[model samples]
Target: MCSSCVMLFNEKNGSILPEYTDLPTLQKGEILVKNKYTTLCGSDLHTFTGRRKEPSPIVLGHEIVGEILELAQNEPFYDLNGNILKAGDLITWTIFAATESDEFVKDKMPQKSASLFKYGHVQFTEKEKFNGGLGTHCVLKRGTGILKVPLSVDEKFAPIINCAGATAMAAHRLIDEIENKNVLILGAGVLGLIASAIAKQKKAATVTILDIDDTRLENSKSFGADNVYNSLNPIEELTAITSKFYKKGFDIVIDMSGSVEAIKTGLKFSATGAQHIWIGAVTPTENIEINPEVMIRKLLSIKGMHNYNYEDFINAVNFFEDHFTDYPFGTFIEKEFPLQETEKAFQYAIKHKPYRVLITI
Candidate 1:
């Protein structure tokens, strides 16, 4: 089969070079997928701009949706839902693949297992050049968690299910309960918006969102945000708004911005016993100081979620399938570029900083 892919040879140079490679033969327990669409994510942008470091000669897109092209012969492959996988079934898999015996799997963080293989983050080799989503084909490793996407789910909406959508699910999973809770989301990007919607669906008393971008704040309202505030406002003004609107502060605080300043501000508005989940700090950043006394008195609990586990991915798919029509998910994609223009797509994503940009493969 013919295959083409864009590779990032050097993050310092910030170039995505196109290359054509011969498709590799399927190995035991492996599955091949023809990537249909991939969305450029914030992490992808970081790698492109050299803010995050990844090995050279890697294919970098990961928010992907594709159809199964083939499965290793002489064995039956089943998805997370126990359905048999076959060619042409639209699907999305966990960003990571880890064997059952992986040490982290026993710790309940399969995504962090010792033998983990992340889809878009690995360096390409002759044996597995199509492992990332930027390519025409992706080889789903043996331990990857696969799920079938409902045909009703729009192609564009399915791509983010594995990344932004799944991470949002994982964030909520960490928080545990949302009913009647005043939920605050920090950031108005794709993850923030999805978290807001999920909180609303869980019957959150109010969904408040904060972002520097007014346009994104305006968009959050459509995604179930009850209060939208520009974080650029003076701290005193923001404190006043939070005091008046949420007298006891927010019951659950979620940070999707990864801004140290934002996390510090969110701490100010968290109520006693509030649960705080941080999902956006994938890259290293300057540490923020915290007052141990204040945290102790408030009985606050803070948790951080990186990628996501298999269960989170399944919940993400189910959430989108059940509510795809409930929100304007399709509108989240700001632009689309063909696979050949993958470089241009990254450039547009960097320049515009839209919620998402898609590469139609």
Candidate 2:
């Protein structure tokens, strides 16, 4: 049995309570982790605003990093040559334990059917036991998919790997296939900064980051962006920067802002044969207008990316180990708090801070 438990619930509007609950026993292929820290994300803000509907009493905060305590006896999934995994390995896994069945992630072929959620839903699973990272400790189940992280990596940096860092790295990996590309990133938030850093590290000729927030723009420069634009009209800023830098549209455009307007603006700046990768989760209710003629004329390819695969997570971790401090990971952090003050921590992340907010357990 666990000593303490905290459950997030929306019994009243904008009110969250961490109620004590029973901690269940761990089963095979599962490991109990003492929650070290979890970071607040933009999605958590959407939840607070009631923009995204969620079932009450649901565990919250998906961006998590913790210490391993206990592990299940079972092991599965091999390497490229089929070797079984063992315990005592520090790793990270996506928040998917309930949907690991054959019906969940199996991408059906011939007819070509994709699963409902590629990483199979960020929802909590009994098998994985900690719904979101809001609680003290979570049980990550094996076969639920986990990636080994370096023990030397700081816990504060771990959560970033699971979500924003992984996504940016994955997008950059995809865009890296094309040679001598100039990339434009829309937004200077944590995701945008991470993406820009990865893009520059991967040899992109130039990286331009756009955001209306001047503070964030300055923050972007610290992360290796060749150019930063703070403007209400990102299109104009992008055009001017491109004219001065590349004198043409960018070879790749990555939109991390997820704003419908940002998507439209990015489309205006996409070069011929350029590819656009969407890492942000745009509002489902919003519709983005696009000209098919422009797409065809520019021969542009637009793709939507979700959570990271194992490779992406590894790359992000490596990136952190090598350059996290040099890029001012410390500068990006706004504040930190203890786990007991999860409410206040989250509120700060939601209402005020943009770069990062962390909770130490």
In terms of TM-score, which candidate is strongest? 1
lDDT of 1 by residue, 26-53 (tens): 8899998999999988998898888898
Q: What are the TM-scores, per candidate, against the unseen true structure?
A: 0.96, 0.85
The all-Cα superposition gives candidate 2 an RMSD in Å to the true structure of 3.9
lDDT of candidate 1 at residue 144, scale 0 to 100: 94
In Å, residue 86's CA in model 2 sits off its true spot by: 7.4
Candidate 1 residue-pair clash tally:
0
lDDT of each: 0.87, 0.68
How do the residues 71-121 of candidate 2 rate in per-residue lDDT, one tens digit apiece? 665445432123344545455555443333444345311011233221212
Best by lDDT: 1
Q: Give the residue spans of candidate 2 off by over 4 A.
A: 74-90, 97-129, 176-179, 233-236, 245-247
Which pairs, if any, clash in model 2?
A: none
Clashes of 2: 0
Tell me the number of clashing residue pairs for each predicted model. 0, 0
